[model samples]
Target chain A: MRCAEHCEVVANRPVATNQFEIEIHCPTVALHAQPGQFVQMRVQSGYEPLFSRPFSVFRRFPERGNFSVVYLVRGAFTQMLARKKPGESVFVVGPLGNRFLVAQPANQVLHLLVAGGVGAPPLYLLAEELVQTGVPRQKIVVVNGARRQDLLVCQEHFAELGVRLRTVTEDGSAGAKGKVTDALKALHGRGELSGNRCQVYTCGPTAMLEAVAKFAQKHDLPCQVSVETLMPCGLGVCLGCAVKVRTANGTDYKRACVDGPIFDATEVVWE
Target chain B: MSEVKLSVKLGPLRLQNPVLVASGTFGYGSEYADLIDLNRLGGIMVKGTTLHPRAGNPMPRMVETAAGCLNSIGLQNVGVEAFIREKLPFLRQYRCAVIVNIAGDSYEEFEQLAERLDGVEGVHALEMNISCPNQEKGGIHFGVDPEATREVVSRVRKRTRLPLIVKLSPNVTDITMTAQAAVDGGADILSLVNTFVGTAIDAKTRRFKLANITGGLSGPAIKPLALYMVWRVARAVKVPIIGMGGIMNATDAVEFLLAGASAVAVGTANYVNPHASMEILEGIEQYLREQGEKDVKHIVGTVKRCKPGNEF
Candidate 1:
């Protein structure tokens, strides 16, 4: 674990509604972090708020040797962080928390991914890794849903994958005019998806995850979900990020930071 | 390559390392065990306990803003008896020092709790949490008033033979005087800073983000405040000081040691990065090698003040 020292915030630009991306010039983190991990960064010039905000690594561009975080304005910490302009630097703690499991499943052919709204960051990372592994673009199908076009983030970036993008929006602002799970059903009906043979990975709102879990159960698909819990310390010491999990032996809860921000969808006991 | 061993000896107890997890940050040392390497730390300072189990405060118990976190975790530990029965044996296997942090609502409760914890085998040390703010106890008793702080430390000193380390609260106006008062009352060591009281507002709802309305803020935002207080108290006190507040890494710990801290504790850093203490321990060793220093002991109180002509 390392804290941000002289790392400068070289770029801060808004990409969506109340959502912005900040590229921090932290060479150490840019060099070390993989796809699914995140960093906790704080803004310097502000009397309005106090506390560092945790954001997932949206993308880590090795060519430029910098990593970026895409975040939404939810609390005072983020609102303040989002307001930070170019040239100002804040402290950061990284490559913190365990990352998603991307090991190639033995005898596996399909990688089904589901993402919702801005929670698409980690899954996009998984997709990027899958692309690099030479998985056929046709085998990687992304079913992403957002409230509207304003909330539908990163679809353009995913489009560049040359893979199929199936989308749904709660409001008919863009894509399919229903929910993501509804689009998932459409895929199943059209024989585009056969859940029994695929390994599913998802990241989104808890409700959407529950919906995916229900689908995994019905089809007996092996599914893993990324869940979010209240984080005071992005470190494992706080015990604030416990989530109930059911394993083959028994069921017990584990921390999101250490045990996982990612878990088997069937194992998670969402309270 | 030099092995970065985190263990150190202070007095009666040989701490596995100087990287003891801070109190209030680590729950009973058993709450999140499987996630961390308990043996890696210097010791474990379980959350502040009393004679009775407390449910603590209401939710939203925590909120993050800027470079700090605000928490109103109102001393929520499962009392002394339950700890003796359940939490104790679980921690004994870990092969690290265990410091039990105790808080009491009254002087009598303090004495009783100390008496009970006296012979607990696995309990390596006793961290006196006298700095806990009690709005109900005459508007400010143990933490704010030096008299009350001294009295509590004095009474507990008579009851327990365990090494006493009094944790001081910085909510008071003069931290030095309060520190001295605890030392005079027979405290062997001191831990500075419980959280500084703070609040975060929800402008959309026009209400407080935390249900407690105001909470104690920790993390980088309070690093300067914590550092200044540690330096201020270190100058006025003789007891070994365990400096803590916004200490997240080895550099932060170095700053504290330079300011006269004998040891340092990692608090909110645990929340942001669970592997913080180990990283800090490594960071300290890296600094020592770079500075051509052999032992970390020499760095304590080495913060050289810049003279008028010393400006380069």
Candidate 2:
């Protein structure tokens, strides 16, 4: 059951350049929140920035009764959120959208988790869960990418999870100075991944997701992507966050808030 | 203080209260059941339904502006058959009135929709959506012209015995023309000021923000205009009015009642706060009690206006 709770800020501070992670103490949300699910936060009490902002659960500490979201200060809402102090109240509605597909299929021998910039939060949670579920640390690989070194977030978190970590950046400021797909190509060339033996999970900007989807298609691997859009009501009533996907017939729009924020790569119709 | 009356009557339809969830904002009512009580509402106007299922428009469908948002959802919904089969049962379990908002590309389709839902078990009323600005055809085309509005209303009226509400478009030269026309064509009530046709542009990208190029605007940005239209339509027509557009709180709702609306529907605010409708409903009762009024009807159309030639 989804609910609206006025959560107390536990910690809200800068995690990296232009990126801040805010933790809120909401037991219901933390206890029920799954990886890739998100919470809609009402940043202020006024109407100037009317709609609540949707943020993916970066980390959920169920025992501590808290969850955190990683956000980039792009506009007024995030800017305001960045200035919030611990103990201040933030109205949140959550445990929303679908969770990442963690149940590995029999043929899938390798799990490749990809992240681009702020998109790393949900994928980080997925990596943590996979490791907890007894998936061999060697079988899981993470590709963290961003525009530059400072923008490449969550690399250390993945490293702490005892998984193989790879870093990519647009400029030569990180591990591999290329896009995430380029790193995937290098991995494939080295036979680290084989056809139909790998399962890919990615979250990032649309351009990056499209490229990853194409890579998975070419490699005959099942891939899942976490998409982002302007979601007014995370409850699916607003129907504003539309993601075009392939249907049995031509094409149709699916509500990213309900049908999924997580979607099978092959089913998404990239424009 | 005496008990305050929240119930209201709109022609043949009687509501438990005057706070309804506007069409399209509250999806089949079940979507919000966990966050708020569905039985506490005056009515639930589900998403705009067409004779056949609609896929709606392409992305991006919605964009936020100053104190408001613009959307071109194009009335995407399961066809009426699926609505009756899959959606209606969930609503039937609740005590709140079920007001189905129906849109069509032609008068024959409107008539068919009305006839199909006329005696349906859970349906309490029908809101003829001749005013949806997001659709490519049918909707606002018939709504902007007075003659077409009257013709469509009467055609649907002829087919259904349920209370009929003609929702008016605000993009016309004069909204009262269509309002009076709807009343003249046997409409039982009127829901004034559907979303105003508007658009937003991204200066950085030099592109329209919405894929539809233009979409209907809703929220507090349009509240004053919606109130003015409701006031105008109230004097022009005798039927009750369900005023909407940018009503975010109890104060906004009361202003509509003072402006001659018998009831008010909460729209865009529902997205901002799922508990908004309940909060507004509680606030309305508090307002009535503070005013020393035992009945809400005492405040309907009670705004004080200066006499002609005596204006300051």
Candidate 3:
């Protein structure tokens, strides 16, 4: 039951460097939102930034009928969204796109979740879902990477979930001084990552996603990636977010709005 | 409470109303089934189709602007055979008219596509997309030249009896010449104006915003420019015109109607609101009832307040 409604903001606060989280009382959207789905939101009434921006659903409070979105202040629309006061109305259309699919083969599947900078929200929510669904917290590993320590905002959330958390930053201001893919390599060297029974999930920038995809392919492990694109309308219409994917016939286009925001890493045509 | 005639006659084609969803914006109709009532719209123009499949342009294909957005989709579609086989059957279930928008690199490609779809069931009309650049010839050269526009439309017109609508490109100078040319080419209806060519660059990154440096601009920013073109073409040719560009609301649709357009297509507004077409349709009906007009046709080209300037 997707819906377009004017949600009232409950809290708008800075959670990290240049990143802010907004919680709104949108019951319909909160009820329908899954782990990897997103919402198209427009904050301003005027015609500037004429298109709605797509944001992944960071948190959902089904009991209180509220949902949260975390976004980095990158442009005018995001700046406007961050400046919005509590109790202000924000137009939102959600819970859109295909969600992250869990491929649990017996009880041997190890879920390796990866997050890159602003792409953390969806993967965090995914980890939460995996834990709530009876997957042992020890079987799940959360990997986060950012430019600096200030940008790693979801460390505490993953810790509270009792999931094993590993982090890396480019500037050595965080846990490990390298990329998340580096941490992945180290885990594989230690025989922690298995090609046979482990499943990988990630949400991040295209470069990072491509690296993860290539790594998973090399290891013969299955991986699912939540991609990001410019989507004016989160629904299947607009055709604004066309992503190329490898099909049975050849390479073809799929709309990121509907076909998936989440797609199997092997199927993505990384050119 | 008088009965208002919302039906409109566009040459040989008759629409239940004057509000239509533009091509490229609306993806084959099923994408919007849950958001709005499909039967309420006058027509549905699916994505642009070609003879073969297209992968479209690279990523970062769209960017937001002031009151508008730009796109370089490069006409990404599954081609004609797929549409007739896989897409058409689904569209047949809807009550609204299903209009197929086709593009090509040459007159022969256009003719072949039109011939293939000539007797296809559920295809209500064929929109000849001359706005696309001719891949065989360089530049946005086909639709810009009156001769090419005439030949393409005439060839397509000969192949399809289902009403032919020649979509004109707005990049050309003196749009009337092209409008008159399309009518001469046997176009039943003329739909204008396609997106205007525009570009945007990121000052900080020192790079273009879109993967394709120049993309088609659509939305509320171009409404005034589209209105003037529709009005100009409406006065030039006797064939009915389907006006579109930056139509966001019912008032914009009414403005196009008053400017001599028989019908209007909601393009960029669809991206803004999935239910925009239905809202515009309802708005038109409400406006007609409020104005005490029995027929929407009465308002076509009815402006008598302004006189022609003495420059002529």
Candidate 4:
């Protein structure tokens, strides 16, 4: 749907520096979304910076026709988006990217979670779903990293869910002082995410995703990663989102907008 | 609820909406079938292709900026043959107009591409991407230098009966001259204001953000510039103009039309909202209703622009 400059922002706030965790009332998308879906939003106005920025559905509030995404104030578009107050309306194109795997009754008893900065959004919702699906609250260990202490937001919600929240700060202000790599390495050594036949779920920056992919593969754990890409047509008309995949389908192409924002780590060329 | 008809005509092509996908962004029309409704568009313009295959520029080719984006993709494509055989079939399934955007390094290549596409099924029109004016034999906005622009436009104009649309480069000092030259050379239509030359630096790394030292800047930053060109070209040439650059909303499209374009295309917005084109069309109809107008064509070039609006 072409988002008319008319949808009221249901929730808008500063979750971090230039980063916001906001929600708008979009029943159509809420009703249509599957876990791991996304929405395309024009970060700003006019023709100069024309394209809309795509964000994953951090948390979909279907009954309320609202959803939220945590984003950094990276640029003018996002900065403009972060500045939007509740009740303001803007055009939004909708739950576009392929979603994450829904809660399935697989044999793996635990979910090893990894996130960085705003990457915490998707994992947060995934954890909520897992809790609802009878996965013990204690079974999910979330490893999150941020450059500084001020960048972390929404900690209380994850804590309230009884998840084991582990923090990695570039500086020693938070939990462990090193980085997420340090946290994962610690977990790997303790068998928390090791030879227990765990399923790993992750979404973060390219470097972090690459690191997680290597760690999961090295340990032979089943891993899936969410890929962030520049997509204009979430429906796959714009080949801007084409990413190389290691698949029999074809050697050269997979539209991240449609084929996936989430994919098996081994199937992707994690460059 | 009123059923607003979003369809409009751009020379020989008929679009379900006025929002056509800009060139160099949407590839060969078949790539995005899964995430979008292909048949529900004004038209789709594939990447710039030439006589031979092009791998395009190197990695780090695209960099995301504040309100817009910078890219030096350099027109990567698999040449016209692969596009015709592999892509068109899947694209044919869509009911919308399919406009082939052609680019070349030489007159021979442009003519070669044009001749081959003359009768391709589902190929409704040809968009001559005269963007890289200097790298090729002619120069960027081939139409910028009227003689060369006319030469290329005339050559391709003669090779195909499909409507010839020359896409103009905005890096020029005067766009209307180029717009007029394309028409003078028998261009059936004109798509104005390709990306403007721009740059972004990584202050910490002390390096350019894009692989290519300089990239084309697109989005809201270029809308006023594009609208100016459309206004100038609208009054200068009789051929229909498909204006683009930084159009993000229906108001933006309507503004471009009032500046004298027959239709408007969404370029960089594709990066933000996958359905921007469809969204703009919806916004345009919403505008027409708010304005109490029954049709949209009446607003073409209806707004009087500040004369300097076309200047760089």
Candidate 5:
């Protein structure tokens, strides 16, 4: 069941430069939330910014009855959200959208997780779930990229999970000096990725996702992407978050809020 | 303290309250069932249904503006057949009036839709959505011209005995002309000021925010304009008016009642607050008690005008 509640903020602190992770106490949402599912948050009471913004559930602490979201302070909504302190109440509707595919224990598929900038939250959660599900720690490789060093979030979190971590930066402030796709090529050159045995999961900016999708398609690797779009009402009614995908007939639009924020790369029609 | 009567009559159709959820915003009523009591609403105007399904517009279909939002959803729905087959049964459990909002690409489609749903169980009325600004055909085109508006409403009016409501477009030279035209064509009620056409631009990217380039603007920003139009139309036509445009709370809802609207529909507010319509309904009753009005009807079209010598 989905819930709409005014949850009290348990903790809200900056995890990286210009990025903050805020946890809210809502047992129903926290316990039900899965990787790639998100919550719609109302930043303020008034209509300065009228619509609620959708944030991915980065971490779920069911025992504490809390779920955290990692967000970048890009616009007015985020700017206001960053100032929210512990004990402040924020209206949130959650455990929405579909979740990413978790590897089965019996399967021997190699899992490659890729994340860019603030997009690391959901992927990090996916990595944690994979490790818990008995996917070997060596089989799970997380490639994290950002514009600079500080914007790269969730690297330490993924490291703490005892999985392989690869970092890439556009300015070369840290890790390899290149895009995430460049690091993937290096991994492929090292024979770390196989066509039929590997599965790729990515979340990031549109440009980067498009590139990642192309690479996954070229290698015949099964890929799932977590897409981010402007959504008015995260609950399926608004129909504002549309993502075009390939259909048997030709192409059709699907709601990213409900149908998925996570979609198979083969089905998505990249612009 | 006296009891406040919230029930209102819109032509032959009557509502338990005067607060109905606008079409497209409420979905099939099941979407909000988990959040609020569906039986408490005056009515539930489900999403716009057509002769066939629609894929709608491309990505970036919505954008946020100051105190409002713009959307070009293109009336995407599962057609009338699917609506009756899949969506209606869930609504039958609720006591609220089930008003099917229908949109057509032509006069034949409109007539067929009305005829198809005329005797359908649980459907109390039909709200003709001729004012959707996002569609390429049959939407704003029919609403902009008074002759087309009259022709389409009259065509559907003949096919169904259900109370007919003609939703009017705000993007017109004079809204009164279309309101009178709908009434002249046998409309039982009027829902005014659908949405004002607007656009948004991204300064950094130097591109239109919406994929459709221009979308319809709906929210608190258009409240005053909508109130003015409803007041103007109420005097021009005898039919009861369902005023809507950025009505966020009970105060805004009551303002429409005083401005000549018999009832009001909660549109964008449903998205902002899932329980907005319920709160607005409670607020209306509270306002009635505070004003010493026993019936909500007592306050309809009661706006006082300033006299020549008494003007401030």
Candidate 6:
């Protein structure tokens, strides 16, 4: 069973504008977590903020029993987390959601890693796993997008891992000027979008997920998109984080905390 | 030093202590089972159950407010029978009392559901929730009307021997009238107040935050309002009360007890901290010990009312 525990912060520092990397030393959570799972963390000690915020696992160092989260300053909780100093206690509950489903026989499949905003963490973590597991670095293509250049984080992290990186920004301040879907569109136009058994994996805001889902549908390709929602418990109990997805019987609301932060792009209702 | 007795009684039911995880927030007692010691709690009130399974509301079911939250879960559950078959067995192993919160669309359904769980072995009590809209009454809720509330409580009272707790909704004109009606209909206990009816809109998008348009307000924001209602009902009714609304810590639970709640249930706090009840339970013990009290029962209805300023 996954446990909710308090982990000591080793570092909580800004890596980019309005973005911070928080490293916590939690042995149990780090040892159990797989790519795509997340942790629900309490920002303050009391009821002022009143809910534990959920952040996807950025990176896990199993040998040292530590995990990192890349977060943007979006609300009070994130703002509190950003100001946290090393050695302070941060309560966390984790390996909470279902892990990213990487299809077996990784050697033959082309892994398409897509990210938006701070959503790059989990996808980048997945890329690292793919490389370590013997999937060729050339088989992985990492595409990231944001509103501007300063907001785009983790580009160099992917490069450091020797994975191919592509970037896009809505304000024309970075690589190809557009959304991540625009980069994918450009790839499709150049006939570099298909062949060799490709699959798409993405995580971001709802608008970006919808566009990625639509693009995958247009190409008739298999895709999995990680989703985000307001979750107080980060457990299936609250029934708070409901995502509507198409089932064989029609559509049903699934809890993002337990059922998935990752789901098939085709099954999502996207509204 | 002697042991401080934490046990509490509600009609024929007895709890290990006065702290319980509230309905809908605890989710069948299995979700937080690993995080906290369930046996330490006084009881576990599972999610709101119905005669049939409910699919619940649309997306954006919950949103956080300043120090509280709004939720329109629409009484989501896998129905009572499925709960018995799938969930009760797991909960039966725990030493804590397991109270099931039941909702219905009509009085008949309420009685029928009561009869179904009449002699169920593992279940300890039934909490009747009349806050849900009554389909038979053209969408008027049962808890809002005194007559409807009395009829449903009386009917269910006759169908089962289990201790009946009528959970009153605060979205009413006079909560005491509903409390009186529930007692008159033979309720053994009164659990108040359920979430207050509330809503929020996204000003920028010109859209409702919740797909349901309106949701029930919970957490610390509703505590003062809920405490007042509990006090009002305690003055009017003879039955025991399980007070809850925005109770985040032991101090809040103590406030409910001082307002005449025989027991307190931690609701929104469970979302904030999975092990909230344990901390609150310990806190209550600490308060009692510090106050030189030998029992938690000493704090019940102990609020001191101030005299008029002119008289003073």
DockQ, each predicted model: 0.19, 0.82, 0.67, 0.25, 0.73, 0.74
Ranking by lDDT: 2, 5, 6, 3, 1, 4
**Residue pairs in clash, model 6:** B219-B246
Tens digit of lDDT per residue, candidate 1, span A114-172? 88986788778778878888888777888878989788877877888776788889997
What is candidate 6's CA lDDT for residue B168?
A: 92
For model 6, how does the per-residue alpha-carbon lDDT over A161-192 read when each residue is reduced to its tens digit?
Answer: 99878999999898889999999998778777
What TM-score goes with each of the models? 0.65, 0.97, 0.94, 0.78, 0.96, 0.96
Error of 1 at B26 (Å): 7.4
- Winner on DockQ between 4 and 6 is 6
Docking class of 5: medium
Candidate 4 per-residue lDDT, tens place, B1-312, comes to 565555677676677777788876666655445456777778888777777766555446666665667777666677899888887888888887788888887788889999999998989999898775324323344645777888999988889999889988887778777777788888988998888878899999999876668887777778888888888888888888999988877788898988888888887766565556777887888898888777778777788535875786
CA lDDT, candidate 6, residue B167:
91
Say which candidate scores most in TM-score.
2
In candidate 5, what are the lDDT values of residues A24-105, reduced to their tens digit? 9999888998888889999788898999988888999989999999998988899999999999989999888999886544
**For residues B76-101, could you state the per-residue lDDT of candidate 5 as single tens digits?**
88999999999999999999999999
> Between candidates 1 and 3, which one is better according to DockQ?
3
Clashing pairs in 5: none
> In DockQ, how does model 2 score against the reference complex?
0.82
lDDT of candidates 1 onward, in order: 0.77, 0.91, 0.87, 0.75, 0.91, 0.88
* TM-score of model 3 vs. true structure: 0.94
Give one digit per residue, the lDDT tens place, for model 1 in B11-54: 55577656777887877676446456787777888878889976
Model 6 lDDT per residue over B173-230, tens place: 8999989999999999999988887889999999999888788889999999999999
Question: What DockQ does candidate 5 have relative to the true complex?
Answer: 0.73
Docking class of 1: incorrect
Lowest lDDT 10-residue stretch of candidate 3 chain A: A101-110
lDDT score, residue A127, model 4? 81
In candidate 2, how many clashes are counted?
0
